[model samples]
Target: MASPACAATVSGAPFAAMDFPLQPRRPTPGQRALAEALARGEAMMGEGIEQLPAATYTDPDRFAAEMRLFRTLPQLVAPSALLPEAVSAVAHDGYGSPLLLTRGADGRAHVLANACRHRGTRLVDGDEVVGAKRIVCPYHAWAYKPDGELSGMPRAECFPGFDRSANGLRAYPSAEIGGLLFYAEDEQADFSDLRALEPDFDAFGMAGLHLYERRVHDVAANWKLIVDAFLESYHVQRLHAQTIAHFFADGITVADRVGPHQRAAVGRAALLERADLDDMASLRRAVTFTYALFPASIVVVSPDYINLLVCMPQSVGRTLVEDYMLIPEPPQTNEAAAHWQKSWALLDGGAFGTEDFGAAARCYRGLASGTIETVTLGTLENGIADFHRRIDAALAR
Candidate 1:
């Protein structure tokens, strides 16, 4: 039998029964004190903000502050460029969120919340062929049109005064830029427009790309920690010595903060080099640019593909990282798919899921130990400092 429709209206409160990973564990007095101290310490680039002391990493209080920052800030989800046709929409539940991407009959993309407006059941399951037309919920037979309006219900007359016009799938705000889609929970966010970063996207050549393969991982670390790993290449030599070290500069990295909203850092060489494809007609010419759309999303551009990282905080210490690899649209072939899969596995296995996270995991353990007093920010990694400051300021509001 189909599950019953939920009672809450989409706009008023689909979140009534939703259990988001928003709450942090209770903190002790010492932890609270330490968090306050760290927040109060001014984080200027060349001043006392040199390196986070070992004590900061080990303190329970500092961890609390990190959680506070994540919960308060408005996170960046997608770029405006990717929304030309909304392909799919993702939703947040108590555990993790769901993403729904679709290509409509009109050859347009539309993304909407993955949760059914009724009873909160997931509307779309897996990556199956949804095709064109309305989305029918497998649970209670409720259906919604592509534009997120109510279409049908199993038994319309069972309940009197049923008003389909008053209820539709709740949609979070979405935008795109540089061929990337962006979603945000805050409807009032002004930074949703990517035209502000036109020069950056043009320089990266992200306009002509096509969405290809995407990989999602439930990473066991704070979202900020995952983000910090990508802002600088300082540890590339030490941590990723064998896997990705050959393609990156171990010591020299450039970090720049454009404003409160974005930070970017470039390595000497692109990580995913495909020099053998000189004759291949569709190869994107640029490689090796790493940029972060402050608060969450990170993008890596290579000659063959562009890797976009979208992260969401799952708990005080856990995060979900979505890694998307976009390549030039090519005929669907087994060999091409296999090659792309191998490329994605290689990057996720070595750079992020392993070495990068290995370092951050240690940092987490140290933070809980109360041994590290504060985190030190490198001058070259000024972006890191700016990120910390922005978090502090946003949470303060």
Candidate 2:
């Protein structure tokens, strides 16, 4: 049977009990700092103004440097919600190379090249999540198990000596943590930093959530430019004036760091007057949290659902973004479906697709004209500065 629908918004409250499947967890020490600052009507600020050269977005050499950073590190594959069960596979082409994401009888997901080992033909054909119980190569009829173990060949005696164990699909070094998948071409890269996000992920209960919908956006702007749009709330009142501005207090977003990642809490002044700060559910309703994952990924926790985006650079002037909408569970009724559909249309269409990305594209065009040499970040926009610094440090290493 379908799970019951999430309760409608109750009273004047921002959160409804049935929207979240897991028990609310207390904010982490770092996250608590964000909440405390929100409760005080203050936000974290930079010591001074920080400026980034326009070349960071328009220069070919600089863009290559940024791409190098991705090559040397593990890239986030996809949110775990996309493949929530065993015997599943998805064709993911957002991260540059074509990759087949599979989960076998082992009940764990693995990242594999989309090519068949025998004749190098594509194994997976579409973007739909499919059961990878057994993949038959459309080119040569060579079959493989979900784990990439070769299972059959058209004519067994055709090849003089064939070692099935030695002829499997190429697999990347990967791990699933915090409902996110991280994989790398290098076999020895460290994932301890990614592992450290467990406490935060546990609080969000991301692992078991249902994937409601997903869209791939091809934007005409530099990837960092798009990422910069989310690291600050300074533009919401103006850029999103018609959509989400009324939901926030002006000049009020507190940011904290978790290793290389960033945590930001949007101020909702109502929380300052509440006496139940100790109640996590109430606190969650009082403020919205956003995570700026290192490199370029974002998680925005709404009152009832989550918006997760992964940004990948396609060129100095272009980017490809994979956007996913996650909910506690699939909507079980027409009313529930309408509610989520409305939420998706508002966020994916108005707030993000049109406002946020539009701003990035406009900024990219101006920077490319060679008129502005530097982009400046003010005290309120310090999170963007901090993020760029981390990027520089990682590239230097």
lDDT of 1 at 58: 40
Model 1 Cα displacement at 196 (Å)? 1.6
Model 2 clashing residue pairs (backbone): none
Total backbone collisions, model 2: 0
lDDT of 1 by residue, 1-397 (tens): 0000101111111111122121122322322222232223312233333564553334346656655443333444543333334333333331244655544445444446777887888887654334436787888989887667788988888868978887787765555455555545556655433446555564444655556655567766666777777765556656766666655333343333445545332222221132122211111221244557767777775545567778766665666777666655542677667766665666766666676666777777666566656776655455555566676676677
Q: Model 1 off-target regions past 4 Å?
A: 1-111, 127-129, 202-208, 263-287, 331-342
| CA lDDT, candidate 1, residue 350 | 61
In angstroms, the error of model 2 at 115 is 0.8
Give residue 93's error in model 2 in angstroms. 1.2
- Minimal lDDT window, size 10, model 2: 1-10
lDDT score of residue 97 within candidate 1: 45
Worst 10 residues of 1 by lDDT: 1-10
